[model samples]
Target chain A: MALHFDPADLAARRQAACAAVAARGLDALLVFRQESLYYLTGFDTFGYVYFQVLVLRADGRMTLLTRAPDLRQAHRTSVIEDVRVWTDADGATPEAALRDILAEHGLADGRLGVEWHAYGLTAAVGQRLAAALEGVAVLEDASDLVSRLRLVKSPAEIAYTRRAAHLADDALDAALTEIRPGAFEGDILAAMHGAIYRGGGDDPANEFVIGSGPDALLCRYHSGRRHLDAQDQLTLEWAGVYRHYHAAMMRTIPVGRALPGHREMLDVTAEAMAACLDAMRPGNTCGDVFAAHARVIDAAGRRAGRLNACGYAMGTTFAPNWMDWPMLYAGNPVVLESGMVFFLHMILYDDDAGLAMCPGQSALVTDAGGESLSRHPVTLTVAV
Target chain B: MALHFDPADLAARRQAACAAVAARGLDALLVFRQESLYYLTGFDTFGYVYFQVLVLRADGRMTLLTRAPDLRQAHRTSVIEDVRVWTDADGATPEAALRDILAEHGLADGRLGVEWHAYGLTAAVGQRLAAALEGVAVLEDASDLVSRLRLVKSPAEIAYTRRAAHLADDALDAALTEIRPGAFEGDILAAMHGAIYRGGGDDPANEFVIGSGPDALLCRYHSGRRHLDAQDQLTLEWAGVYRHYHAAMMRTIPVGRALPGHREMLDVTAEAMAACLDAMRPGNTCGDVFAAHARVIDAAGRRAGRLNACGYAMGTTFAPNWMDWPMLYAGNPVVLESGMVFFLHMILYDDDAGLAMCPGQSALVTDAGGESLSRHPVTLTVAV
Candidate 1:
């Protein structure tokens, strides 16, 4: 039997969110992004019913007002001290609820921070909020505040992620068994897609890369109906989201017998990936870890080593509320702190042939070392 | 048998797009956004392929390049003459291919219009392009270009859209049958999710919304799950993209009997929707159409009538991709020309609840009248 994440744990998560927000020196971080909202409140009800202007005020009052039609659910999944329903009447918008919160917190004269990531906030929401709130500062990056809180996966979260990884591995096994020279990319994708969902997953939740033959040259190649050639390299980059957590790692291998270059390229990438994995630690900067992979490629004397061979933080969503402030895109200097869960992928792409290898490796940072989520062996495959 | 849309008719859509792009006084356009790329290129093998660029010049040279992987499939779909394959060794990224097209067409030395709505060009790609070419201008608004090109729906497009709309309706029917008082929004969404995929439209493409009861109070009132109550209004926004065409519409329904105010609100919205549909016609400005809905709301003496209505362009994708500069959002003052395909959704929402007759109607702007693509009757049905 599968383990279910408890609804009660939402309260603890909310408390953790409150602490993170306060530590960041925010008055009350407006958690509007879906992932952040889910991470903080454990409210997954749709319609943004739990889509809240979550005000985790400095005073420890976790107040929320949602627009869900089922008020009980808003209460069930959330640990908010107060819940308000949005009706079809005037004075019931998020803007209105925000007004009451401001007045109650004596924030009538203080600045209210707004989360800038929502597509719903539209340009109109900003204007409307400005017109509504007298003194408010809508900051752009509340994402980092709550994002850091999710870096260390809860015990439950890791198990769920491992399960997701298992699903991906199982799907890949099925794909390898079913794939043949004459198989269509779309059909093979359909097989993988069906397996994941039937095996208990949101299939579309996992992105797929099932390119074959010469198509594997496209950096972000999409699978198609091309008859897979005998000596083609079928590169796959598919991952699934588990209970809002993420699991991403990829590998590419040959159909029957690989071409000389195909084998060389795959081996080089694997070596680079291994070097990068070995470099992960609690005290390293994002770039330092990336250099591990870059150095491997340079040592191999490849014309171009790797491009963006670094991974960003991964937790509840494919992309969390915000990537850790600094990243490994060269200039970003965000350090790898203990308890950070990063879905790292060292990838390269050729826009011309649409071939890409987003061989991602996800790991959790610890005081001792890093631990990977996937159980798939690093060995390359040659389908018989 | 499902009615298949004719690919031959896409030529007219392309003509409209080419004309719209030219009218913008630009030499060439770089299609980066998925909807625009599909609209122009029509190659739909797993969308989300990395940077498939469609470059159309003023002299009518339309070329699509990205990777060699898609080159063979590209031949089967695209009508464009230059189907260049971008290989890793070729050093041809989509950006590079775009630059070459511009230089070949003498467009590199001047302003080249681009899809500003796209995510930032990847740093690596940007570095390569910027180092190669200097003094290039990027224009942000091509809304007019898309609006005009995609405005008029071909007979084939309309049929596909009609079927798409019906598919959503069919999916909703399946979703509701599984909805019980204690059933979860997540479960209901999952049920519909299975039906849509099994029905053979690939995946749901996006997450399903199953908010009922209090969850309906949220903006875009939908989410993963919440327990449904007998007293709650079950609302859904759904669509299916079949053959790369979008058919979206929404419904607000009660799980059991209508609540005290649900029926009245529904009736008001229905009346408002009817008023808007009746007023749709050619030669009318989008502003005029918006005003027509506002007038109906005003005549009904509802507190606010126009606050929730939608101005949508009809095609394969929803929102902005269907067309260019010819949008129906507020402040857009385009003339409603004949042959345009658009949708009118009149809705009302606040903190307490959301009520509306949505995806109000799909219509073709004609010299004589407005023709609907789908004709499902508007009514409240108690689950039998």
Candidate 2:
């Protein structure tokens, strides 16, 4: 079974992670974040909801502890050779099994880095694992260690993100073609997702945010599907996911004729987005990009409608969300490095007008500036 | 904004939850699980990935603390009146905001119930929250308090599940029609998802597990869509979710004619599923159903191929997974009750032959036995 990445690439990632652990004075690292695990070993599985842990020793030994169902999955997807399965039977303690694995690796009394902020490591599981390792090992919080390493993408990862961007553009085109007065939101969503899948894109970490009319004012996937009203607003926030690498896009479309405040909102949002993109240079900080967004919106006297953060980092993320670290918020000092992917969304919601105008695009940070990954125009799409 | 259910229905659910919290001697319940929040207040949003908390006081006061993006979302979808938005500004402390909310509710010195096992509460966030409440209040792990109440479905919820089942049947039909030699797995998946949306179903809590060839042996959704071989096995496990209510279905299909071992495996899986369904009576324990599944598979000398748990309780759930509590495992003393839904999958993976046969169905427990929710046939689907 071949891995998702080249063996050499995966090995380099593992070596870098091991070096980071050693530099941090940790003997071993217990990784629970699915993205970190995939980045290190190419192990891609949704079985992390259950008790699954990857023990990466600084000496280059790696072990995966998972359930029986994912045994073959890890074998096929990951390059890790040492794998163990823990039973879900009565009185079965996976924490104990983890302890035994640590003992076998001769790291029972060593300092271990744990991902406390990871979605894979819940409070209950963390508490149980802490109890199991108490008196045997000292657990240190190293949640952002691998995440920071993944901030910059490799050429292969950037290629996947670029492909995902193309798919997102195609999906947006399909959605625009399907949007019409009296068209059901579900049908429009079907068209967008259908185009994505037909383009060979994988499922996104989160559901696409799509709604019509008043529902568009809200940025969530609510229960019921509404029919598009003539001269109504439709908000769409979707991502094209390829190998868990997401390139997100958000655009608010006019169902028929543009409303009174629609054109103004669109123009301001596009200008703000362009400024944010322009500020995403190699040396600029995330806060600098947010400042650019604020300057444009504030100059237009639309600061009340603009969001605090214009964008965030995007990468190979798991479910529950697609948003990554180093968010483009005020006072965030994270430097923008080349090869980093970002989704800059200029979201402005006017409560008085009951209107929402969000024009967003995904881009790759280059030494020169931000290169647009999505080819779709920033103008407000009008479905005639 | 009208809810999916009646106002009275949502009120009753909140009342029940409040009673449960009071019974546990908790002054207030801090709900984080998306399913629990939705069950109690119809607060449906994917924004739970960020820091969001719902405070439900036993004295009938309710408050929701979330980010700016979800303020309108909570108002439109839920009945919660007092909604507070925490800023993402520099030096913004959401924990402080949460602490203030607790103080305002007079729960500062009270025992508060927290969902420590929930995905909404990461270990880092949980730790910060505990630190914020330290010396001011006591935090108790009441993760399963509301989940246990949601085990039994209301009539309105069951109605939604039945509708979702209908959509699942339609989706399966679409998938079967699209499956053939040389067909792309992505296209088949597209067809199924498109059918589901057109049938007015919502996005499922988890990605549909669809794979072919050796990939079918793995339960998780891995990357790469395969072109079906002339002789290949394909597995599909999907659910049709309606207003968060889910009715799941799983089936294994042969691209061409059924192999020699395929029929035998299918027969054994179907028999095991039938036996498990028969044992799902109102008074029987979850283990009793698992025992029946074990007996059937063990008698066939295929016990090693089967999983420890035959099925699990299912209902409204969020992303990352769809499987719910009270799993049908050996020695689990959770008793079956009327209105409880279960998805019994007789998964048999014969790695030696590289063959996987899983026939599953979702059902509702009744006085008469398990009533099938998914109308799809529990037999091997052969696409010739």
Measured against the native two-chain assembly using Cα atoms, what DockQ does each of the candidate structures obtain, in the order listed? Answer: 0.11, 0.72
**Per model, how many backbone clashes are there?**
55, 0
Residue B351, candidate 2: Cα error in Å is 2.0
Candidate 1 structure, TM-score to reference: 0.66
Query: Candidate 1: lDDT over CA atoms?
Result: 0.55
Candidate 2 segments exceeding 4 Å error: none
Question: Model 2, B227-252: lDDT tens per residue?
Answer: 89998899989998888888888988
Candidate 2: residue B193 Cα off by (Å)? 0.7
Query: Each model's C-alpha lDDT?
Result: 0.55, 0.88
lDDT of 1 by residue, B1-384 (tens): 111324555555666666666777776776655556556656544323244567766555777765544555565445555776554321235555666766776775655555534322322233344445556545434533553566666666666666666656666776777765665565555455445444444333344443465555332422234566765666676555455465555666666566656666667667766665655677777766667767666666764422432556666542212222344544446677666766666655533444433334466677765566555556665442
Candidate 1 iRMSD, 1 decimal = 8.7
lDDT, candidate 2, A1-384, per-residue tens: 536689899889888888999999999989999999889999988898888999999988989999988888899889888999987777789999999999999997899999888776777777788889999999999998999999999999999999999989999989888898889888998998998888888889888998878777877778888788877889999999888899999999888888869899999998888888889899899999999999988899887743668889999999878998878998789999999999999888777888889888899999878998988889877887
- Native contacts conserved, per model: 0.03, 0.67
The positional error of residue B359 in candidate 1, measured at the CA in angstroms, is 7.6
